[model samples]
Target: MPHSIKRIFTWIFWIFVLWAIFTSPNRAADLVLTIWEIILNGFNAIAVFFDRLLGG
Candidate 1:
């Protein structure tokens, strides 16, 4: 993408994120928490697989 377009998208994304955060902080927190949990679970699963493969 062009530099100007990229900047516009970045600004728009941040604006939306900020709006969501301010409009409903609890909802935003829950969304972030859920995403974090999913990421952690994925990492945990990968670790378990590696441990099993290494016979640890």
Candidate 2:
């Protein structure tokens, strides 16, 4: 993607995040935690798959 487009998207994303945080701090925290757990679970699943594939 073009640098300008990337920058615009980044700014928009940050703006949304700030809006969410300011509108409802608790909801924002829960959203972040949920995202984090999803990412961690994905990583764990990948690791398990690799481990099983390698016969470990």
Candidate 3:
């Protein structure tokens, strides 16, 4: 993307995040937890795949 568009998006993202944090902290926390769970699940799946591939 263009630099100007990237900056605009970055600003918008932070603004939304700040708005979420201040307006609905509980929901924000839940969102973060959900994202973390997704990341961990992805890693676990990758590890399992590698283990199976290596016959371990």
Top-TM-score candidate index: 3
All-Cα superposition RMSD per candidate: 0.9, 1.1, 0.6
Instruction: State each candidate's clash count.
Output: 0, 0, 0
- Reference-based TM-score of each model: 0.90, 0.86, 0.96
Native-referenced Cα lDDT, model 1: 0.99
Please give the lDDT score for candidate 2.
0.99
Top-scoring candidate (lDDT): 3
Candidate 3 per-residue lDDT over residues 1-56, each given as its tens digit: 99999999999999999999999999999999999999999999999999999999
- Candidates in order have lDDT scores of 0.99, 0.99, 1.00
TM-score of 3: 0.96
Overlapping backbone residue pairs in candidate 1 total 0
Candidate 2 lDDT tens digits, 17-40: 999999999999999999999999
| Lowest summed lDDT window (length 10), candidate 3 | 1-10
Residue-level lDDT tens digits of model 1 in 1-56: 89999999999999999999999999999999999999999999999999999999
